[model samples]
Target: MKFLSSLFAIAACGLLAASVFAAEQAPQLSGCAAKRQDITTQIENAKAAGNAGQQAGLEKALSEMNANCTDADLLKQQEQKVLDAKREVSRRQADLNKAMSKGDPEKIDKRKDKLAESRKELQDEQEKLEKVQPDEDDD
Candidate 1:
């Protein structure tokens, strides 16, 4: 009886562990894949409803998503580029601050130009990132 009870306890613990592991393994959708699925569904629904205008728009969106989100590696690279751009902006801002502290007109102008360039780069990178990421509304 004692041995049988111990065996049951061990089995119960094993089952509990397995359940916990399974629960922890949530399904993660690939950015492009999810978008593709969503767009496909929207396209089908639009076609069913005979909404030609909406269908055209959804098709265009789907094509853009396919172009941007298909390559996971490219998406990751774009994300990295955005991070680098943000860092560059921060560095440029620091330089501008230093120039301001020095009270030199020429230095301040140069730093301001650099800062503008950095900000533009950051904005471009952010746009690229947005293209690869899943839209919040899609979720």
Candidate 2:
């Protein structure tokens, strides 16, 4: 129990520090924000159309956009953001697993929620990246 608490505390502190650093070094998107917004709107429209296959294809397109974004440095930063978020989610999941193995139901549920939130963030970033690009093919 004590070890788990300590682990949680350390993770929390690390998260806080990373978040602060990210905030300080936040990238400026003033020039391309509008285009990004438009792309996101298109993605949402596709997602709401109730077509599973189309949605999956749109998601793949989104991932490509994130990978091949226009601004070289911004694209690299965005990719790093995805990687960092994924790592954090994985760490949380492992912590949750450890807690569950010790019968911590409440912590387990909380961790699951955190994981879902992380995944949602990843999806959102992908959508933003897709919004920046010009769609070449209609899928």
Candidate 3:
């Protein structure tokens, strides 16, 4: 019994360590980072053109970079939410596959619909994030 307890404790510690390591290496907003780089290029172009108004827009974009761009906390939260949603969708898909294998046509169709909805939600969030402009100026 003591040996079994020690083995269980070691396994638990290993699991905990793995979880912590995974959390530390969480997914980041590379997409947002790429967008920021593009914005920087646009700002440089505006500066070259010597357009005061465009420069102002570039400044605003820089301000947003200082505001939302560097803030990884919110991005991490959003990414985690998306990951959870993906896991749920994957679970449903597995169920769908099982149903199909068992020849349950009606259940398979229902599961496919649920999977489609989950995918749609994920796509919408991605699109919205992609559309987030750094500058509010629209002239």
lDDT of each: 0.86, 0.71, 0.73
lDDT (tens digit, per residue) of candidate 1 on 18-126? 9999968955454566568779999999999999999999999988877766556757888999999999999999999999999999999999999999999999988
By descending lDDT, how would the candidates be arranged?
1, 3, 2
Question: Which parts of model 2 have CA positions greater than 4 angstroms off?
Answer: 1-70, 133-139
Candidate 1 lDDT (Cα, 0 to 1): 0.86
Error of 2 at 88 (Å): 1.6
Compared with the true structure, the alpha-carbon lDDT of candidate 2 equals: 0.71
- Candidates' RMSD to native: 12.1, 21.0, 16.5
Residues 18-128, model 3: lDDT tens digits: 999997897433446655766787888888998879888887987787577543554565566677777877887898889899988899899899889888877766654
Give the candidate number with the greatest TM-score.
Answer: 1
lDDT of 3: 0.73
Residue by residue across 1-139, what tens digits does model 2's lDDT show? 9999999999999999999999789754421454355456667887788767876776776666666655555556666777887787788778778878988789889888888888788777776665544344633
The alpha-carbon deviation from the true structure for residue 37 of candidate 2, after best TM-score superposition, in angstroms, is 8.4
Clashing pairs in 3: none
